[model samples]
Target: MKISDNCYVEIHFTLNNEDNEVVDSSLGGEPLPYIHGMKNIIPGLEQALEGRVAGDKFSVTIKPELGYGERDEDKVSIIDAESFAGFDQIEEGLLCQIEGEDGSPQLVTITHIDEEEGEVTIDANHPFAGQILNFSVEVMQVRSATEAELRDGLTG
Candidate 1:
């Protein structure tokens, strides 16, 4: 069946950066599945997958805005180093999860550690933000979404 709203789709995809570095892939793993037009995946990828059928293959490039949103300087901030006391050590470029303003867990990358001042700088932007995404994808399956799947925004 062709992919359409609420249709369950399974796709094998390899995602790369503008530099051609593989950012992620489902080549050897199980195909990734999602409910079409439900925002289960990025807007660009989902839009590109629309109307495709099983066995279809295509490539697409997504701008940062459509991918992860442009990196925001406001998303970078410094907090008490004590927040990471649970860790044996904290260093630059380390990814961790911290509570966001709404009390939800948010992923952040440690960009700097000031041991002398007890401050840790973190960037809350998604690691993929502000970057172009190049994807090579193959449709593995396309079928009507089950009642439960549609309601739950997932697939079996």
Candidate 2:
């Protein structure tokens, strides 16, 4: 079977940043499985996988807009460290979610901690934002989506 709408696709892929650094990979592990056309993966990768058959290998570059989107400087903010009193450790690289302007939870990463300054730097942009993603993917399997999978809009 080929990858298409409602199909279950299993792929092994290596994702690299614009700098050619391996951001992620599934080469030595289980293949990632997702239902095609379900928005379960990035738009660029999903579009590239369309009509692909099992055992096909290809490389594709996804622009920032299609991958994680252009980074917004406004997403980065410096807030009072005292606001995080309940947390045990407030260290760099820690991920947390804060309420957004729309009253929704927004995930933010702790980019820096200013000890003496009593401030913390948080960024809401995805880590990969603003960078081109280079993906080398090998299709491992493709099967018709099951009835339950379709109803649930996902793959088993």
Shift in Å, residue 110, candidate 1? 1.3
Q: How much lDDT does each candidate structure score?
A: 0.92, 0.92
Kindly report the root-mean-square deviation of model 2 from the true structure over all alpha carbons.
1.9
Which structure among the candidates has the greatest lDDT? 1
Model 2 score (lDDT): 0.92
The superposed Cα distance between candidate 1 and the true structure at residue 3, in angstroms, equals 0.7
Per-residue alpha-carbon lDDT of candidate 2 for residues 5-117, written as tens digits (9 for 90 to 100): 99988999999987899989999999998999888998999999999999999999999988989999999999999878989887899989877779998899999999999
Instruction: Write down the worst ten-residue block by lDDT for model 1.
Output: 147-156
